[model samples]
Target: MTAKPARDPRDYSWLPADIQAFIARTEAAYPADAVTFSIQQQRAFYDRLCADFDPPHPPGVTTEDLTLAGVPCRRYTPTAPRSGVTAIYFHGGGFVVGGLHSHDAICAELAEGAQVVLIAVDYRLAPEHTHPAAYDDCAAVVDSVPGAKVLIGDSAGGTLAAAVSATRGETAQIAGQVLIYAALGGDPSLPSYTRHAFAPMLTRADVEFYGTVRYAGGVAPVGDVTATPLAADSYEGLPPTAIFSAEADPIASDSVEYAARLAEAGVPVEMTEEPGLVHGYLRARHMSEGARASFRRITSALAALAAQAVAQ
Candidate 1:
């Protein structure tokens, strides 16, 4: 069974032209099979997208290479350093697709909007890298980034961000996390999961397929908690969180459950469910009005958290 995508919010009529175009084009490229494609194929697909996507660079952002867990990562820094607060961004594509290049536009926008350095990791994807490989790489990068930092990612990257928070010891220093449309688990009972089962881009089967590849040889963690941050036994000690969920996305429950857990743990958290948006709407920033709103919400949350961290 597949859940139907929610209709476009009535307000999308006021969205920027580029965002609207992005929605049309991306929607045309239906069924992003993140779980089914091989790493090579996925890489090629995104590479092509990057090649075609030429987003205007923010005034002073520069890109650099850094070593995390001994794996090479790409970092984007602002020309003007704002303070100690940093955003280590992970690109989403399940546990498989997406790279620094594909995410360059959004990262640059984030850097510009939040007025903070954005370190984007080019983590290895599965089924080649598999389970903990991606997680380990992310943890290493977070640990290595100098100064107080906020972890951020959309979709699969969002899942890893939460996982890293969970696995970090008392000494690991992430100040906050921003999860956008994260996958909390493989369970299909979540309302959004059942509602958007056949969502144009991401579907129920697509998630299952990705899970199989993500855990191919590794021992599957019991239930969604540990495997899914929402499923984690406790949210205590994890940094404050900001969740951005799309009303039409199947993974909406991930953010909702995570927000509830964070609150229960007495951890500070805020959640925003964008009406009528679909999965991966961040990439449609240029075409969809919803994407721009989503981006603004993301940066605003980061700025608010960064301010709190500064005050402390």
Candidate 2:
């Protein structure tokens, strides 16, 4: 099948006014070439970027910084009683940047929205640490979280969530997965990759660069399900999934294709594309109506998944 055509610059004009303003403000603070900076600089900048758009922490929520099975994590607990469900989140930074602190606000909002406990893993990063390290860290935390759990992540973290869900399908531990604009395994030649290769925030080249650094040691096999879940032989028996894709993201096709594969595998899946939004739109939830709507959908999906786990 032919890939979707490239998006026209004019298409951005159709976005909500608040989204447009958010993008403008973001561009002014972070230039396109910012990705070329050193890893240290990138981390600092990313942390600042996340902080700049951070939504207010919901009232009646408590946060705790702790480690799960040797992996550092930050937990967000809503004031309301827990439903015995937990969401293990991996932060998006292409497996190179981002940490528990970077995604603190997002996790808090999600916890408040879903009324479930949220644990954001601060997985090991690349260049210093390699492939299996980050994957291993995330898996460790996932394994530690007992009982019903949902895997949730954005971008690189999304990849980890999918990988863990597929690799551990036999355990029946995960009830569902929520991937937000995930960088799931997809061919760079796909339509979305070509069309949004140069889109704002994340680009095709940026994705490749991050992958290179993430697997610098090359210890893990390229076909390994833990490294690339999309390359898995089968997605059968996996839990229900919700995938959110940004219409203007280079990896948009990743989510689209993944959802299709899951459906074919007899796994229930829902895929939603947010128009006029770029990669990392989760950070704009407080500012963009479109983002807020998407956030609500995500929370609703998580809530449903939690209920399903309780009923079983």
Q: Per-residue lDDT for 4-111 in model 1, tens only? A: 976653334443455446655764443255345656766676666656554877877887877776867777777665787888888888787777777887888788
Per-model TM-score on C-alpha atoms: 0.87, 0.93
Q: How many residue pairs of model 1 clash at the backbone?
A: 12
Model 1 bad stretches (over 4 Å) = 1-23, 27-39, 223-226
Error of 2 at 127 (Å): 1.5
RMSD of each: 4.5, 3.2
User: Which lDDT tens digits does candidate 2 get at residues 1-312?
Assistant: 999986684355666688778777776666556679998888777777777877679999999999898998898998784576788898998887788778888899888888888899999999798888888998888888888889999999999999999887548388889999998778787799887777777788888787677776644366787887788888899998989999988999999889999999999999999888888888788888888898899889887787787677
**What RMSD value applies to candidate 1?**
4.5
Best of the candidates, TM-score: 2
Which candidate gets the maximum lDDT versus the true structure? Answer: 2
